[model samples]
Target: MELSQNKRVADMNYFELIAWLGIGSSHPGGFPATKQNLAVLQILPDEYVLDAGCGSGLTACYLAKTIGCKVMGIDINSQMIEKARTRAEKEGVSHLVEFNIANVYDLPFPDNKFDIVIGESITVFLDKVKVYREFFRVLKPEGRIADLEMALLKELPVNLRHQMEDCFGAGTNPLSFEEWHNCLAEAGFQDVEIKNPQALKDNGNIVMNELKKDWVLIKDLTNKIKRQPTLLPRLQKNAGFMKRNRSYFGFGLIYGRKPTPVKLGFKDWVRQVIFRKKTNSSK
Candidate 1:
C-alpha cells in the first residue's frame, strides 16, 4: 500500500527500501544513540514497553534481549510489520517482542497498560499533538517516554522548507528544540528534556560509514536505477540538497514523564484554548 499520496515517486516504497537494504538502525545516531537514550528510561525486566512506529523491530528486539522486557512494536505499514516479525524471530526475541500493524493516532492497546512508550525517528511524520496525547492516554502514571525526532536547528526560509518537504515527501514537519519542549509540556508531559543536541552535519560521516557497510545494496540499487533512469536524477538532486543544507537539519532525543492530571485554573484553561487555536492555524 502507498504510505502517502504526497510521496512524489510512485515506485518508491521508502520503508521497504530501507528494510531491503538491511539498514537496521537508520535513525540519526543509529543504535548507539538509541542505547544512550534508552538508558535513561530505567526500564525494568517486568515492564511492558510500547515501541511506536517500530520499523524493522531492531530497537524492540534489543530491548527484549537486554532488558528482557515485553515489547510490542507497531507500524502502519504491513510490510514493515512483517519484516519486524521476521527480525524478532531471527534475533531470538520473538517471544518477548510482538509486531502489530496499527495506526499511531489510535493505538490498539487499552489505557494505562505500558510502563514505557518510546519511538525513534517516528514523530516527525505524525500529528505530534494527537499522537502524544494518545501516548499519554495509554501510558501508566509516571510512565516514561523516550522519543528521538528530527528537528530544525533554526527556522528555514519558505523556499528551503518547501524544498525539504518535496525531497522528503509528505509529513515532514520538524519543530525547533524549544517548540518540541513546549509541545511535550502542552501534551501533559513533565520534566521534558532535549538531550544530545548534535547537528546533522556532525553525524554525516557516521551515516556514510553505514552506507559503506551496505555497499553491496548500494551497488545493486545503482544498477536498478540504471534500468530506470528517471529515478537517478531525482535521488541525486535530493542527496545534493541534503549535503548542501546539512547544517540546518538536526535530531534530538527527548525524554519526558506522564504526570497525573491537574485541574486547570482559568488562566491555564485560556492558554490551552489559545494554544489549540494556534496549533490549528499552523496546520
Candidate 2:
C-alpha cells in the first residue's frame, strides 16, 4: 500500500502519517521504553509470542533475533505489514517471525494460542477494556500481556486534551496508571500492575535517541521527507504538543497475566457433588 504523493500530512490520520514515514517506534518513550519492558518480560526462546499492532516489525524481529522466540506480528494496516515482512527478511529472522494484516479486535487465531502478547502504543486509541478482552481471549492459561502505553500523570485540562487529540487523534485516550491497571483487571487479567512507570521527558531527545537506535527509520527518512514537504511540520506539531505538555504524560508497561483454570481431583469433585445436593435440599 503506497501513500498517495499528493496527499497532505494534515489530511492523513495519525496511523497513516506514521505508516507513510515508516517510523518503527512511534510510541511514548519510543524504542528505549520497549527495550526496558522487554528486559522485564524475560521471554523464553520456546514461547510463541504475538506482537499486536506491530509497526515495521522492529520489536518482533528483535525478539526473534535476540531471544530466538517464534513471533507472529499483526497490524491492521497493510503498509505496516508489508514493511514488517521486509524487515523480518532483511534482519534474517524470517524463519522466526511472521507478519500479517489483521485487526486486534478480532484476532484470527484460536483461543489460548499465544504464550505472550506484546503491544506498544496501540490500545490508547481504542476501547481499553475491549482491546484487553481480545488480548485475554487468545492468550494461553497464565499467559502474559505487556502493553507499553502512555499514562496520564494527572488530570488533563480540557484545552490541553483538545490539543492532544489534534496532535494524535480524536480517539487517543490515555488513562492514568490506576485506570490502566483496572482495564487489565476488568479484562480478567490477574496480577495486574504497571511496571517501569516514568514521566515524559524531552521529545527531541527521545526522537534522536530512537533514531540513533533505529537504522530502518533513519535509512528512508530523507526520501520520505523529500517526497512529502508537510512531513516535518506534522512531526513538529505532534512533538511540540508533547514537549509543551510533558508534565501531564508518562508511560509504563501495563503488565498482567491470564489466570490459569483450576482442575478438580476425583475426591474434590465427589465432595462438590455432595455439597451441592445438601445445599439444594436446604433451599
Candidate 3:
C-alpha cells in the first residue's frame, strides 16, 4: 500500500468517512436524535454486538467501553479497519473490541451468532436486500438491528440519481422508504418500524448545519451532474423534489429485529440463498 497525504486516502469509500460520523452527522438525512435513537435499541454488557461497516471504529469502541460489551466491527476497507483497530488500542478497549476487514455481502459468521447488529449509514454501500438477509443469518434469537440510512420520501429524479455516483464517490446502493420496509419484511424481521429525519427537525438542522462547508462541494457536484443531458432532467425533477422538501419529507432512521425462526417455504430458502454468501474468515 502507498502512503496518503491525509490521515486517510481520499478514495471514494474512505473519503470523509470517519470525519463525517466522528464529527457528527455527515450523512445525508443524518442521525435523527443520535444517542437517543440508539438508546431505544438498548445495548448491555455481556452482549455480542456487531458494528458492520464500522468506518473508524469509534462506535465499536464506545459500545465496548460504555456498555462493557464485546464489539466486532467489520468493513471492506482494510485501511479503515486498521485505523479502527489502532484507535481501539489508543482508547484502551482493544481487548473488548475486534476490528476486521470484510464485505457486508459476505459476512464471515454462522447462523444465530450476534446479540445485536448496528449499521450506521453503511446501508448505502451495500446491496440492501442481500445485507438484510445476511443480517438475519448471523443474528441470534430476537437480535436487534439498528440502521441509520438515507431513505427518499419519493423517487429520486434522474439528475439526483445520476449524481449519486459523484456524491458517494464510492458506488452507493439506494432504496426508497417502501423498498426498505419491504426488504426488512422479506428478510423475516419482526416488528419493523421506521422514523424519518424530517420528523425530528432540530436534529435535521444540526446535520445540515454541520455540513455548511460541504455546500460548495455539493453545489459543484450538482452543477456537474446538471450539465449532462442524460442526467439533468431527473435531478431537476425527482431528486430536486426531495431536496426541496427535505425539511418536510426527507430521510429516515430505521430500526428492526430478526425474529425467531418462522415456518419456511421453498421460496423462503431461495430468498435466504440469494442474500447469503459463505465466507471463510474470522475476527
Cα lDDT tens digits for candidate 1, 1-283: 3344233343564454454444446677777778887886678999999999887677898899999999999887776677678778877898899999889899998999998999887788678888888999899998978889878888888999888777665677888988888888888999899977777764443433454554323555655455556555654555666678878878878778998778899999999999999999999
Task: Return the top candidate by TM-score.
Answer: 2
Clashing pairs in 1: none
Judging by lDDT against the true structure, name the best candidate. Answer: 2
Ranking by TM-score: 2, 1, 3
Model 2 TM-score (2 dp): 0.91
lDDT of 3 by residue, 127-150 (tens): 777888898899998998877776
Cα RMSD (Å) between model 2 and the true structure? 3.5
Off by over 4 Å in 3: 1-25, 28-33, 195-249, 262-283
lDDT of each: 0.76, 0.90, 0.64
Which of candidates 1 and 3 is the stronger one according to TM-score? 1
Candidate 2 lDDT:
0.90
Off by over 4 Å in 1: 2-10, 13-24, 202-237, 261-283
TM-score result, candidate 1: 0.79
TM-score of each: 0.79, 0.91, 0.68
